[model samples]
Target chain A: MTLLSALDYASVAVFALTGALVASRAQLDIVGFIFVACLTALGGGTLRDAILNRDMVFWVADPVMLAVAGSAAVTVFFSAHLLESRYRALLWLDACALAVAVPAGVGVAMGMGSAWPIVIVMGMITGCMGGLMRDVVCNEVPLVLKQGELYVTAAFAGAVAAVVAATFGLETGIALLICAAVTVTLRAGSLALGWRLPVYRARPPRNGPRN
Target chain B: MTLLSALDYASVAVFALTGALVASRAQLDIVGFIFVACLTALGGGTLRDAILNRDMVFWVADPVMLAVAGSAAVTVFFSAHLLESRYRALLWLDACALAVAVPAGVGVAMGMGSAWPIVIVMGMITGCMGGLMRDVVCNEVPLVLKQGELYVTAAFAGAVAAVVAATFGLETGIALLICAAVTVTLRAGSLALGWRLPVYRARPPRNGPRN
Candidate 1:
C-alpha cells in the first residue's frame, strides 16, 4: 500500500479502538460496539469524501477498512476490562490517529487539485470528524466544540504544514511526513503537558463576545 | 423545481427553525445560530446523499437550501422568545419536516435504482438525520432514539408506503403524496394522542442479554 493509504488504515484502527472503549463504558452491546467503532474510524473520512464530492465513501468503497475496524471493536470489547486505563489509552490513540489523519485528508484534497485553504479545511475535517461523531452519537458534548480543546487546532496546524511544505516544492512523501510529525508532536504535547487553547469565557453582558 | 426538490427546501427551512430554537435556548450568538440552523436543516439530506453516493449534496450543490435555512434561522433568532412555546413549535415543525423529508429521500433513492429496503432506509435517514444532528449538537438525546419513540417508525412507514405504491404501479406524484400523507398522519397523531410503541422490557439475569 502507498504510505498515505497505510496511514489511513492505521489511523482508522486507532480510532476504532477509542470508539469501542467509549461504547463499553456506556455498557452497550456488541452491536453498539461495532457500530460506534466503525463510525469513529470512518466518519471523518466519509464526510471529507462526500464534501469533496469524491466518488465513493472511503470505508464503503473498501469493506476491508470496515472489517478492520470491526476487528478492533471486537478486540476491545473482550479485553477492555483487562486494561489498566482505557481513558488514557483512548486519549493517546486518538492523538496518534489525529496525527495521521491530517495528512491523509490533505493528501486527498491536494490530489484532487483543491486550493490550499480547502486542503487545510479538509485535513482538519478528516482528523476531527471521527471523534466528533463518536461523542455526538454517545450523547456527550462534542469535544471538538468545547472551548478549550486543542485537538482541532493541532490538526489545523498540521494541515497547514503539509500545504505550506508542498507550496515550497517539497516532495509529496516528505511533506506528508512533516504533516504527520507536526500533528503528533502537538497532540502528544497537549496530552503530556495539559496544554489547552485559551477558553472562550462568556464575559459580563456589558462586555463584547469572547474571542 | 421538481416536487422532490421543493419538498427538500420546505423541510430544510422547518428543520432550521428547530435548530435555531435550540441554539437560542443555549443562548448562542448569531454565528452559532446560523451554524446550528444550517446543520439542522441540511444534516439529513447531506447524510442521505453521502450514503447514497449521489452526485452532489442537496444543499451544497444548490445554495438555495442553505439560504432558506439561513433565513429561517434569522427569523427564529429574532422571534423565538415571542413564541408562546418554542419547544412545542420545535416538535410540531420537526414532525412536519419529517413527513416531507421521508418522501423526498425515498424518491431520490428509488430514482437511483436502489432496492426497496435501501430506499426505505434512505427515506428514514432523510427524515431523521436533521433532528438527530440537531439534538446531538444541542446535547439532547435524539427523540428518534428514545425508547419506543414513534418518530423513526413513522418515517419508515411513509417510505414503505411510497415503495409499495410504486411497486403496484402508482404514479410517482401520487406515490409520494401517499408516502407524505401516511407519515404525517402517524407523526401528527402520535403528537396529538400520545401514541407510542411498547418499550422493550429487560428480562431477568436468567436470560442472556438486556432486552
Candidate 2:
C-alpha cells in the first residue's frame, strides 16, 4: 500500500507536468493551464470509473487529490520558464508518467476483478488515453497513434504480467511490484531502443464509393 | 415508431451537416471531415448506450444509419458553396436538429425503461453533448454551456412533457409529438426572444487554501 501510494503520487505529479507542458505549448492563460492539467490528471481515471460504474471517482472522493494535482500545475506554470532543458525534461517526465501510471491502472482494474484481457485493455487505455485526449485538444497527432515508442503495448505487457503472476498465487504486493517493474522496463527499453509499432495505413479501396 | 425513425434520421443528418460545416472551418481534410461528421451524428448515442450498458450501439447495429449521415455530410459539404446565405442556413439546420433530437432522445431513453428524471437527463445530454464535443474539438467555446439560447433547457422541458404525458396515459405517439413540439417551440421562442441563461462566474473562496 505504501509503494502504491508513492507511485500514485509520482504518476499524478508527472501527469500534471505533462499537462502544464501542453498548456504552455498552446500559450494558454492560467485558468486554461489549470483546466488542462486537471483534465489530463483525472480524465482517464474518471472515464474508467464511469465505465466501471464506481460509486464515486477517486478525485471526487478525495479532494486532496485535486488539490495536489492543482498545486503541481501551478508550481510548474510559474517555474517552467526557468528550466534550461525543455524537450529533454518533457520526455523524461512523460516516460516517468508512463512507468508509474501503467501499473496503477492495471492494479486498480485487477483489484476490480476484471477479466485478464479486459484488464490489459483497460490499463493500456487508462495509461495512454488522457495524453491522447490532450494531444487531440492541442491539435497534435496523438503520439500513441503515430509511429512512436511502444507505449500502449508496454502497458498491455505489464498488465498481463500482473494478472498472470496473480493467477500463479503470488501475493498482491509481489504482483504489483512485478507489474511496475515490467511496465517501467518495457517502456524505458522502448524509449532507449526507439521501438515503435508498425504503421498500417488503410489502402484506398479500388472503385471506392464516390463522394 | 415511424415518426421516431424519421426524427432520428433528420437529427442525425442535420447534425452531421453541422459537423461537416465546422470541419470546413477547421480546414480538416476529407477523412477528418468524415470522422467529425460521424462523431457528431453518433457520438451522443454512443455515450448514452455505453452509460446505459446497452448491447451493440445503434450505428454499429445498423450501418445504414451511418450511410445516411455520411451522405448528408457529403451533400452539405458540396452544397454549402452554392448557398448565398450560409449563416441563415446553419441557424435553421441547428433548429431542425434540436427539434428532432430532443424528443428522439427522450423516446429512446423511455423505451429502454429509464425512470422519468433519468430519462430527462439522458434526453438533454444526448441532444447537447455531441455538439459540445464537436465545438470543443474544433477549439470553439461550447455553445450549449454559453449564455445563449436555452438548448439544454429546451431539451429538458421536452423530455419532462413527454414523460408526464405518458404517465397520464397518453398514447406513445401523441406523447412523442407533444415532446417534439415543446422542444421546437421552446428553441424557436428562445432564438426569437434572445433568451439566455445567466452568466456564471467563479466566486472568491473564503478561508480556502491558497497556492
Candidate 3:
C-alpha cells in the first residue's frame, strides 16, 4: 500500500478505537457502539471532503475503511466487559487518534491544493471533530471548547508544520512524517505535562435580587 | 431588516425553541439547554456553509445569530415550566423552521454557484441536521434515520422546487416562498396523514440453540 494509504488506514483504526472506548464507557448497545465507531472514523474525513467539495466522501467511496471500523466496533461491542478501564485512558487514546488524524487530514487537503489556512482548519476539524461529536452524543461538553488540554492546538500546530514543509519543497513523504511526529509529540506532551489553554468565562454568575 | 435577515432570525428562534423543548424533556440543566439551543440554531447553517467551502461560516462571521440563539436559550431556561402545555405545538414549529431553513440554505448554495444536486443536499442537511444533532445529543434516535413521517425527504423536495424555480427565471423572493410552501405542506401533510418511510429492519428474529 502507498504510504498515504497506510496513514489513512492507521488514522481510521485509531479513531475507531477511541470512539469505541468512549461508547463502552457509556454502556452503549451494539448499534450505538458501531455508530460511534463509524462516526469517529469517518466524521473528520467526511467533514474535510465535504468542506473541500471533493467528488465523493472518503468512506462512501471506500467500503474497506468502513469494514475495518465495523470489525473494530464489533470486537469492542462483544469484548467491552473485558476492557473495563477508567476514562483517563480513553482520553489518552483519543489524543492518539488526534495525532493520527491531523497529519493525515492535512496531507489530504494539501494533496487537493487547498490553501494553507483552510488546510490547517480542516486538519484540526478532522482530528478533533469526531471526538467532539462523540462527547456531544454522550451528553458531555465538547473537549475542544472546554478548558482542557491543547487538543485542537496540537492539531493546528501539526497542520502548520505540514503546510510549511510542503511550501518549502519537502517531499510529501518527509512532510507527512514531520507533521505526524509534530502532532503526536505535541498531543502526547500536552497530555503528560497537563498543558491547558486559558479558560474563557462567558457568563459570570448573576446573583438575582435576593431570590 | 432585510427579508433574509428576518427569516434567519425567525428560523433561529424556532429552532432554539425546538431544542429547548428537547432539552427540557431530557431533563438537562440550564447549560445543556443553552448548548442544545445554540446547536439547533446554527448547526445546520454551519454545516451547509462548511460543506460548500464558503468563506466565513455564517455564525462565525455574524455574531448576531449567536446573540439571538443565546437569548432564546436563556429565555427558554427561565420559562421552561410555562412552556409545558406547548410541547406538541413546538413540534409543528420545528417543522416550520425546516420549511424556512431548507430554502434559505438552497438559496445560499445556489448563490455560491454550487451544482444543483449539491445545493439540494445542503438544503436537506440544513433543514434536518440540527434536529438530528439535538436528538442524538439527547440520546434519542434521530428522526431522519428512523421510520418516522417524512422529514428530510420533504426538505429535499422543497429545495428541488426552489432550484427549479430559479432555473426557470422566477424571482428569488417568489421562488423561496414557493419552496417554503412546498416544505410546510409536505411535512404537515405527513404529520397529519401518518405517512412514514419503510422501516430498515435488518432481519426477523429467529430461534437460536440454547447455549
Candidate 4:
C-alpha cells in the first residue's frame, strides 16, 4: 500500500478511537459507539466530498475505511477502562489524526486540480470537522469553537503549507510530510503549553420589562 | 417553477427562521445567524444529496435557496423581539418544513431510480436532519431524538407512504401530496395534542468506580 493510504487508515483508526471514548463517556450503546466513531472518522471527508461534488464519498467507495473505523470503535469500547489517563490519551490521539487528515484532504484536492483556496479549506475541514461533529453529536461544546488552544488555526497553517507546496509543484510525499509536521508541532505545543485564543466574554443583555 | 419547487423554497424559509431564532436566543452575531440559518435550511437536502452522490448540493447549485434562507434569518433577527411565544412559532415552523421536505426528498430519490429503502431513508433524512443539525450546533437536544414528540417517526411514516405509493405507479405529484399530508397530520397533531413517545427513564450505570 502507498504511504498516503497508510496515513488514511491510521487517521481513521485514531479518530474512531477518540469518538468511541466520547461514546463511552456518554454511556451510549454499541450502535452509538459505532455511529459516533464513523462520524468522527468520516464525517469531515463526506462534507468535503459533497462540497467538491465528488462522484463518491471516500468511505462509501472503500469499505476498508469503514471497517477500520468500526474495528477501532469496538476495540476502544472494550479497552478504554484499562487506561487511567484516558481523556488525555483521547486528545493526543485526536491531534495525531488531525495532522494526518489535513494532508489527506490536501492531497486529494490537489489531485482533483482544485483551486488553492479550495485545497486549504478542504484540508482544514478534513482535519477539524470530525472532532466538531463528534462533540456536537455528543451534546458537548465543540472543542474547535471553544477558547481552548488554536485547533483549527493549526489545521489552517498546515493546509496553507501543503497548498503552497502544491502550487510550487513539490512532491506529494514532501507536501504531506510538511503538513503533518507543522500540524503536529503546533497542536502538540498548544496542548503542552495551554495556548488558547481569546474567547467572547460578554453576553448581550436579555430584554425584560423594558420599563 | 413547479409546486414541488415552491414547497422547497418555503421549507427553506421557515427552517431558516427557526435557526435564526436560536441564534438570537444565543445572542450570536449576524454571521452566526446566517450560518445557522443556512445550515438549518439546507442541511437535510445536503446530506441526502451527499449520500446519493448527487452532482451538486441543492443550495450551492441554486443560489436562490441560500438567498431565501438568509433573508428569512435577517427578518427574524429584527422581529423576534415582537413575539411573546417565539419557541412555539419555531416548533410549528419546523413541522411545516418537515412536511414539505419529506416529499421533496422522496421525489428526488424516486427520480434517481433509487430503491424503496433508499427513497424512504432519503425522505426521512431530508425531513428531519436540518433540525437535528440545527439543534446540535445550537447545543440543544435534537427535537427528532427527544421523547417529547413523534418527530422522526412522523417523517418515517410519510416517507413510507410515498415509497409505497410509488411502487403502485402513482403520479409523482400525487405521491408527494400523500407524503406531505401524512407528515403534516402526524407532526401537527402531536404539537396540537401534546402527544409524546415513552422515554427511556433509566441509564445503565457504569461498572463499580468505572476504574
Task: Name the candidate that leads on TM-score.
Answer: 1
Interface root mean square deviation per prediction: 8.5, 12.0, 9.9, 6.3
Once fitted onto the true fold, the runs of candidate 4 whose alpha carbons sit more than 4 angstroms away are: A1-39, A50-86, A114-121, A136-139, A145-150, A153-178, A185-211, B1-43, B46-96, B113-125, B133-141, B144-208
- Tens-place lDDT per residue, model 2, A22-48, is 766655545445545765776676677
Which parts of model 2 have CA positions greater than 4 angstroms off? A1-46, A49-108, A115-211, B28-32, B202-211
User: After superposing candidate 1, which stretches have Cα over 4 Å from the reference?
Assistant: A1-43, A50-124, A137-140, A147-211, B147-149, B201-211
Please state the CAPRI-style docking class of candidate 2: incorrect
Models, CA RMSD each: 7.2, 9.8, 9.1, 7.8
DockQ of 2: 0.05
Predicted complexes: DockQ each = 0.09, 0.05, 0.08, 0.10
Give me the displacement of residue A152 in model 4, in angstroms. 3.5
What ranking emerges by lDDT with the best candidate at the front?
1, 4, 3, 2
* Candidate 3 lDDT tens digits, B78-171: 6655543445655787889899888878778877888889988988988998888777766667766656677987898899898899899998
B142, model 1: CA deviation in Å? 1.8
Residue B99 CA displacement from its true place in model 2, Å: 2.2
How close is candidate 3 at the interface, in terms of C-alpha RMSD after superposing the true interface residues? 9.9
Can you write out model 4's per-residue Cα lDDT over A152-205, one digit (the tens) per residue?
A: 988999999987776698998899889999998889888988777677665655
After superposing all C-alphas onto the true structure, candidate 3 shows an RMSD in angstroms of 9.1
Best by lDDT: 1
Q: Candidate 4, overall lDDT?
A: 0.82
Local accuracy of candidate 3 as per-residue lDDT tens digits, A94-125: 77788778877887878877667667767776
Clashing residue pairs for model 2: none
TM-score of each: 0.62, 0.56, 0.57, 0.61
Task: Locate the minimum summed-lDDT window of 10 residues in model 1 chain B.
Answer: B26-35
- Better candidate number, 1 or 2, judged by TM-score: 1
